[model samples]
Target chain A: MNRVCIVGVGSPSGDDQAGWLTVDALLDLGIRSGDGVVIEKLDRPGSALIPLLRSTAWLIVVDAMQGEGEAGQIQRFDETGWPHYGHGLSSHGLGVIDALMLAGELGSLPPRLDLYGIEIAGTTPGSSPGRAIRAAATRLAAMISDQLASGFSIPPGTQPGYG
Target chain B: MTESLRSVSIHVPVLARVEGEGALDLRIDNGEIAELRLRIFEPPRFFEKFLEGHLYSEIPDMVARICGICPVAYQATAAQALEKLFGVELDPWARDMRRVFYCGEWIQSHSLHIHLLAAPDFFGCSNAIELARIAPEEVRRGLRIQALGNELMDLFGARSVHPVGVRIGGFHAAPALSRIKEMRDKLRAALPEAEALVRWAARIPVPQDDQGFVSVAMRHPDGYAIEQGRIGVSDGARIEAEAFDDHFAEHHEPFSTALFCTYHKRPYLVGPLARLNLNHAQLPEAIKALLAETGLELPSRNLFHSLAARAVEILLALHEALRLLENYRPPDSPWVPVTPRAGVAIGCTEAPRGLLWHRYEMDDDGRVVSARIVPPTSQNQGRIEEDLRLSLLNFGLDQPDDALRLHCEKVIRNYDPCISCATHFLRMRVART
Candidate 1:
């Protein structure tokens, strides 16, 4: 019954620690599970999205990143053209879109899904996390909070969120 | 690839049909191989990182998640490691029961590979699902056979994927003798089906070779080691299970997340082929007959011959299971008492895939101070790279790139490398029954 399926992907300890923070930020926005928002923490991008998408209308996945672009850049996109493990999306063994693609093929996929890829500059092995990710996570939390406060005027599950 | 292509790196993201997500990268520069990374970028789940705060008594419960297919191997190794910490040497029946349990893992995991993984490659299909379309009965039979192994484990562990029965010292609740009897009776029927599978795989015309061999598994004074033997290699690298790190080291490379391991400054093979080559003398008479019936010989060095070797192992597991059932007795205690003490313990057992190595440094209170898990795939990483470099010469560069890429994928697939296991280490998170 959650309005948004918040699928969190990334390592909590690795330096590009923004993704884990993003999940906490989403929760700080008072996005309670089954209140039209479901939170899932995954080790990597995986097919775990299939079941989550089946019942929820809007899917918002959070993950850390290091792009050719600047750090703390939020790469938000609908993963339609994406390969299950997207080309050049070398974050981990399993990428985001490809898992959904496999889910679709396996008859376990839901239609509306969005990935909020937050780029980070580094990995902090054997420690907590970096700074850029924490700040970006805070901003993402505010933006998401604003959208949710508006009741996401988005359709029950249509067009994802960020209304 | 030619001299110009040698510098190129090929990254395969999903390394399919194995246990979990993994990848392979082969770096060849100027026709000399520069690097081979069977990368296990499955994410740092902090398995080893978290065991720091956990009690030693809870070790077995936590380690099972290291692998979905080979939980018994994990359970056995952890139990052994903790036993060293607790000063509980296993009784003979307890040891036998552990072996019987491992036999179940070998049968299930190997059967999965032979049918669901290896068979499709030889049959010209992307997956066994395609093969099922042509031979539904064969596929069904295969699934049923596979499910039988699952059922056996389910008796102890509760599920085919990861069982709950295994613990630090021994089982939580001993399996009823009747249950073992039932599994043995069922195994009697299941044995021939395994032989049939091997016979079919034997007909596939796999590329065979005399690659040098090495194995890290249990060796007994009696015969082939099921648990608790020193490590042995074809080139005479021998040592106790505790001494695995004395000769090998894990390298963290940029290409992949999985750590690559090397023995004696060279890549060496593990898993069924290694076991088959090194411990052929330890195989049982019934399995020897299975090999004879299947028209295969002992000491098959060709890695592809692993399928035949697996079938024979299945026969041995089934035989062992029956014998265990006949000689079964519930132990006086499900688990022996333990007193945690300061010590570094190392344990190794033959996973259905290969040797699974576990080393733990425990505090006086039995808290895990540090942990290192050397999964079979990580050890095989270098071997995979060497095979890739060697395989290129066989695949003339005159061939198309796509064809060559597919061949490369196939060669990598032969190892059934598991990335998830290599990346995870002990930080204890208990799963309560």
Candidate 2:
């Protein structure tokens, strides 16, 4: 039962890299690997997420979302609210939600999960995120840190540290 | 009553499930199909052109981007081609390791196609989600099997997607014996699921047709060919891999961006069906016995049975991979060092889809002078058209447009055609009058 933060990232440029940027921000805020928290950056995580979910109790996924929102808008969703986020949230081919659902079907879903989405202006091949999104990336990192420190208490499965 | 007739046109703006984007257009004139086109307008990635002037050593990883699903095929083919030009023999360990790595790919790609992509078509489900609702256990089983394939790739290549372990003369490094044993154990555990998949595929109601099309695949004396073989065609034409370009020609068509390939001025089939049909004799006795238990005869001509063929190959690959790993030992050195030489060489390997052919001409400096890559999908582009034309005739153009479209999609999918691979190398549009 590990608290795993799986960041879905893209090639180092553009809004798609928001996931990695958020991970960097979290690291800067002292969320080191050995601190009972593990972080990973993946490119099109897809079905590869299943094996990772096996040992995870709390899972946080940060990714860029495609939606009709101002650039850098932050959307926080728990397990129940995922479907309401619409299908276009993931910038990757299959997106994080699909992977989560597939994992659920395979009985590989972690008991607790959260998704942080940073809406972006665009994802042009070589372009980086807009300034607003960069600022939002920092904000989202703090929000995640706060949530993790609070013991991810917000949910359907909130049993404290059990082996 | 006065005689009257109306024209019909069916246009699918976006074809689903197959990798990448493409469309199908059908035109009907007075209940008769006047035209059918498979238009693949996905923009070309210009992989072959980009290979020019790159160091020979860099070609494997670069060409791998051609298709995520078959990156190992690209890497191995490129490595073999370059190694041939260098005139170096890979140590037996490297050769066997390459086969095992390739087996992982076949298992991964085939299982994905069978469970996630192709099987739903037979079940009349729109996608895996719906199929899951109908058969939850089956979908979960599929995921598990698919994961095993990825695990195998991870054990050898270090990571499946565009694995970096592949190098010019061999791998960048070899796996430990323990890892090999672990993978072997897992593969053995997955054997029943693989067998079940064959049985499941055997039951899928496929459209029956004796296509009588020319089937082509690689033939090796040792076993089912993956990396090495002579080109064997159903028409009894056997040619060396080096002579691939001599017998086949790629033709450009205005309607589609993918180049349609013709062997000796005729369309042919490849991929799982071709491999199984041609290499049935080469399969191990246990594998052949498993197929016999399915009660389906080998060398099937029904193109729809390609699904079954893919399932059979998955079983074969798992068995072969275990065998390759049985006596695994770390190589003295993972790769044979090579000095670049000036020459033209070719390598043809059976991708999960079909025969992937690569030819490279390099300067003495080891920089590529030119490169030509004929992916499996491009070679099947012509055969797909012929299948569509003939199958549509049997399907009857007078059927409702929706029925026609669904059947057409299934026909295209039966080949499990990778439109993305074709377009990067090379559309599809259908019109009728």
Q: Each model's interface RMSD (Å)?
A: 10.6, 6.5
**Model 1 - which docking category?**
incorrect
Query: Which 10 residues in a row give candidate 1 chain A its minimum summed lDDT?
Result: A83-92
TM-score, every prediction: 0.68, 0.92
Candidate 1 residues A1-163, lDDT tens each? Answer: 3356777777645555676788788778776676567776665533223445655665677777666667787777675544233233333222565445434444334345666778776665567666667778888877766766775444454332110
For candidate 1, write residues B1-433 as lDDT tens digits.
Answer: 3433534444555554334566655544555446555666666667888677788767777888677678888888888877866778766667777777777787777766666566666667665545555554555555556666667777777655557777666777777777877787888888777667766666767765555545544455676776677777766557787777778888876766677788866677788878777787777776666667667776665666877677667767777777777767877876665677888988887888788888899888889999888888878888877777666656653344455466666676677666432111112121111
Q: Which tens-of-lDDT digit does each residue in B1-433 have in candidate 2?
A: 1111347777776554346666777777775666677888777778888999999888888987777778999999999889988998999999998999999899888877777667777887776656777777787777777788887777768888878888898999899888778788898999988888888889888777776788899999889999888899987889988888789999988877788999999988989999988889998898788788887786887788988998889889999998888888998899999899999979999999999999999999899989899989889988988898888778766666666777787788778787622111112333444
Runs off by more than 4 Å, candidate 2: A2-5, A32-36, A83-93, A153-163, B1-6, B420-433
Identify the leading candidate in terms of TM-score: 2
